[model samples]
Target: MAEALVDLLAKVRERSRGLLLRLEGRYTVVGDLHGDYATLQRVLNEWPPPYLFLGDYVDRGDKGLEVVEEVFRLLLEGKAAVLRGNHESPAMNVDGGFLDELCEKLGRGCGAVYKEFEKTFAALPLAAVVNGKVVALHGGIPLGENMRPAPLNRLATLEGDLTIPGDPLAFQILWNDPCNCDDYLPSPRGPGAWLFGREITKTFHALHNTRVVVRGHTYVSAGCATHHGGSVVTVFSSTAGPYRKTKPKIAVVSDGVEVFDLYTKSRAACPEDVDLLL
Candidate 1:
């Protein structure tokens, strides 16, 4: 198992970039799975490829290893694109459950495997641009009065190297959260991250010429939620559990974006406010 993990980690390193671009075509974007293997499998069965996963595949649930294995298998088979979430960092493993799960499943001497997985996490992309219109990532965009997003073209070549980014922009790309305010505000998540508002989202779209930003991190009651006037969408695929009350959802991107609940298997209309905004 450890040998296979090492090989998989190497494959992830060889294939992933910091940012992926020109992902043109119909695709399903999945949110944080948090080790809910059954729900992850259900989402995959319901949504056809090509698929993009917004990370947090492991941790917090009973089947972290199973979820990770399935996602990595798909990734290795060229069936999906996986981005890194904040939880992917080694620093987060203790609290996130991946580390403990590994110890339990692989025994105490699995340090090397754990380290290899960390490298794999570092190699995962930070974000992806689909059809040149929608941007998908794990967290939110960075915020600052004078801050402008890095060019999308350049971002495509960014690479991860097994360490959390120290660059403010890169850090925020993995940690920031969207807000309803008119400008950037301190994030309750921490000191470095900030909550950005709709105006910022608008500016980002204008700068990038993109229509929408899709991300995952926070759980929403409706399985998915549109913020920043529909310029930003958050999808959460983890099933209704002790951590959250909402059902899980995945975003389908074709002619337009549609969200489907994993449990109910029902398509949900975009909120009326989002309709007007978009």
Candidate 2:
């Protein structure tokens, strides 16, 4: 298992992926799982990848480790890609209960497993661009100079493992949330994170040369929510732990975007139930 993890890490790093993972094809954009393995498995049984998982794989739920393993398995198989959510860092794992779960499950042997996961997490791309139109990320964009939204291409590349959320751009990309205002606002999540507005989303799309922003960070009761007049889509695909009340969903993106109601066994049975998206 250890050897396989090392090999997977090598394969992931060996790729020429920079800040964005560029792909041209249809994909199922999943939201934060937070270790909800059952929902993840069920969704996979139905939806056909390629899947773009918007991070937050570990922590919170009961099967974070299993979730990570399964996601990586799909990734290695070339069926999926993953983004780095706020919880992917060590600081988050400690607070979000993944560390406790790891210790309890693996006893003293969890350290090496965690080290590999940490390294794997660091190599994860912060965002993914689908068909050069829709942008999927764990969080939103970062604030540029003058505290404005930065150009997506002008961002600096990381030369080391991001064991922690120390880098400003990386931090925001993994922690920031969207809102309904006209500019950036302070986020209750923390000092590093911010709640951006509609224009900010528009500005980000303009600067990044993308039309839509699909991200996962906050909880939405419907399992999906749209901000910035549908420029931002937040999908929350979890029905475990503290998120039992939320309905889990995924964004199936091709020429356009459609929200698949995961609770339904057959997507065709309820075609009209799909949420509105541009």
Candidate 3:
């Protein structure tokens, strides 16, 4: 409920945030919300705050405004932060219909209303370091100027405004995917999104001195999935849009990653099943 979110919208305007967040302690890694307010409420009720929301809060479903507002409210509360997802940007919003949905609600006032949302989206961090162990983000590692995996520290320099349409590190961080392949492959999601391989994840771990990467973007029917032999985990939190009827999941990061079934309300089995990029 976040106290209806209207009372907090004004507060959101007064706020500005960072590009990369360093978070400690245990927090639940919630995946792409995609406007499923019902599922978001369920996650909060079950798991509570101290959450890392891998973005895409809007688009491709109803209740986008509610989801975004609730997320903004949580950020204002100081216990949670969201990573920018590709869908959080302008192109995807226009494609995914969130802009139109927002337009219908605000009409001629759309510019002002959307600007607040846009500014908030622009300020969303691109990545988070969880307890200095696992790396959680909306997507996979970004390629450097040499078209290779960039230095881990480069994340802090990213201006994650969600409007960089080129192959910039921030854009890749929000759009890339990890795959079973041996190296990087051009993502069918199109230009900026690349499908990275096991070595990429392995090298990423070594370079960052981190153990694993937890991310969201692609949908997995089981609600949770492990790629590159458990080095990369993807969790999906919404059962709406194209992911309907599937189990929505959250990866709880504590001493280790524990996948929770939002639909079944139970701890999920370790999933080796690949998502096939569906």
Candidate 4:
């Protein structure tokens, strides 16, 4: 496992360095990783470049520290931009009693690792701009004046107090989802909307004057799901299985502000995976 992680990190560094230098345009957005290192590795290897990870780098799997470290390296190399998913927040994890468990899993004498984790988490961007379209955080539409994606852009600039709630942009960026969907409802059991229905998505797009919004927070059987007049798309990188599944989906972005998916293997349901990475 350690060797594999080392190799993955090395590959991420190399690929990210090259990709950052040459690629420009909208970013290929990936869903929550949840510490599934192998799945993340496979996607990175198959299609890398001009990508962004939509938070949840730790928890639900082993190697959370390694995941953050390698992701931090990617940020440094400029290969990708990261968003602060709900799971990345220490306060949220602490309230849920997962912080102590995670600390135990990480073992004692891991202060440096913990500090580094906090630092990297602090540095994640709260939202992204694909062309003129605004993709603001976790789930549900932003509430009040606090929910706008403009301030969330500061997430890319912050390196301290990543978990504090003083900055409206801080928490809202990872917690807000588009609220105009009908078919998909926000998960009653999770943070933010279980699913932002299609209705909410259409309204949001109309209000924002953008064609699409991208997000990740819930699990979708098909690896990717869309709603709101196809205005909002959710991409799930982790497959459903006791361990892992085979059909991993990735998004690729073009220079023209278009996003589509790059499937691991040919699947019958979708003739071809559309690029939805922007």
Candidate 5:
């Protein structure tokens, strides 16, 4: 069993390396990783590019450094890109014990990794426009009427200055989640704000002429959710288990959308049972 797992990791590393040389399509979407290096390894190994990691690569699990290194390589080698998540720019420094624990796991010799993670976080975009058909972000759209593509373009190529507008689009990009309506709700995490509803997502799709707004932030144990006639599909890659007992899932996008549950080793089309959001 040990040998098989090692072989799997090696193959994944090779496949990730292959991404350096070539890629196709505008992008492939990844759900929240939550620092699961094993799942991240399997994803890179099993899937091809071009792919976009929807963020939350750190915290909530072990091997955060491994996750960071693989993704950093992918970004530097042009195999993939990333968007910011709440975890990447968490609400408070007081809540980062997990990051410190990750540091411990990676050990004291990993000062370079610590620096690398900081750099990677600095580079992550708040959003991306793919094939002009999809607008993706770590979270859904934010509140306010002035939201536009300019912010997304700016975010995609973010640089040195970390600016926060009173209505900073970056904050919304990482914190927004479409809920029942267009309203600002007090952030459960405190100091932060939460904007819930489909208005911004709809505006984004229409503004960009994209059909879907893809996101990750809220956890979906079943993998993903599609709303507003597929206008938005929120995906969660981290499986609903503490660790090894449950299998991770992938949000497979093609003609429409499907969930490939690693646990069941089965593929199912988008849920037909749920109501398409307003």
Candidate 6:
């Protein structure tokens, strides 16, 4: 298992980038797991492969180690694409559940391995483009003047091992949230993160020539939410632990974006049903 993990780490370093583009085929995009292994498995079973996971695989849950191992195993098998969430970064994981989970599961000697995972996290792409029509990421794009988004190309070649006190760009990509207001505002999520409004979402799609942006960071009660007239969708797949009240969701991209509610085992057609709420 350790050897496989080491190999997976190396492969992710070489093959992964700060941004990726998917040009064809229907894809299933999942949201934050936060160490809910059972829910993760169920979602995978329901959605099948060609899956893109929107990070937060660890931390603040009891099954962090199990979830990480399973996700890595699937990744190695070419069954899924994993993006780094805020919880995957050293800044968040070092003090969150991931490190503690590692120490407890692999013993005190797990420090070196933990460092390797951090490196892997650093290499994970901040965003993905699907068929040039959608952009999927863990967090929303940064807000610029006139509610414009920072260019999608700016994140294309991002490098380096990101610590919390590290790259501001990466920090924003991993932490920002969406809002219903008309323009950008300071996020209650804290400094360095912005609560982006619908206009920003619209401008981002116009700038990138993409019609949709799929991301996960905030918790949505319906398990999924669409913003900016369906230009932005946030899907959350973790139902256990901290998200007991939230029904997990996954987004399916075929003719158009469709959100599946895992808890109710049904499809949500209206974006209003998936509104972003605290």
The RMSD (Cα, Å) of candidate 5 is 7.1
Worst 10 residues of 3 by lDDT: 1-10
Could you give candidate 2's per-residue lDDT for residues 31-88 as a string of tens digits?
9899999989987998888988999988889899789878887887889887888888
Error of 1 at 2 (Å): 1.4
Tens digits of per-residue lDDT, candidate 6, 173-235, equal 778877777668787777778877877777777888888878999887667777767777888
lDDT score at residue 75, model 3, on the 0-100 scale: 80
lDDT of 4 at 54: 75
Report the lDDT tens digits of candidate 4 across residue range 179-257: 4435344344444323334554555566656666666765554566655545666666765232265244555444222
Worst 10 residues of 5 by lDDT: 15-24
Cα lDDT listed for each candidate: 0.76, 0.78, 0.78, 0.53, 0.57, 0.76
Per residue, candidate 1 scores C-alpha lDDT tens digits across 111-170 of: 888888887887777788888788888888865436655555655455544366665666
| Per-residue error (Å), model 2, residue 57 | 0.6
Error of 2 at 242 (Å): 0.2
Superposed on all Cα atoms, the candidates' RMSDs to the truth, in angstroms, are 3.4, 4.0, 2.8, 7.0, 7.1, 2.3
Which residue ranges in model 3 land beyond 4 Å of their true spot? Answer: 1-15, 159-162, 165-167, 273-275
The TM-scores, one per candidate, come to: 0.90, 0.90, 0.91, 0.68, 0.73, 0.90
- For model 3, residues 1-278, the per-residue Cα lDDT tens digits are 22333346557646655667777788878998899999999988888779889988999888898898788878888868767888887778878988898877656766566665666567667788887788888888887766667876775655434454454788888888888887788888877678889888888888878888888888877777888888888889898888787788898886457788876768887578374454
The TM-score, computed over Cα atoms with residue i paired to residue i, of candidate 3 is 0.91
Error of 2 at 161 (Å): 4.2
Candidate 5 Cα lDDT to native = 0.57
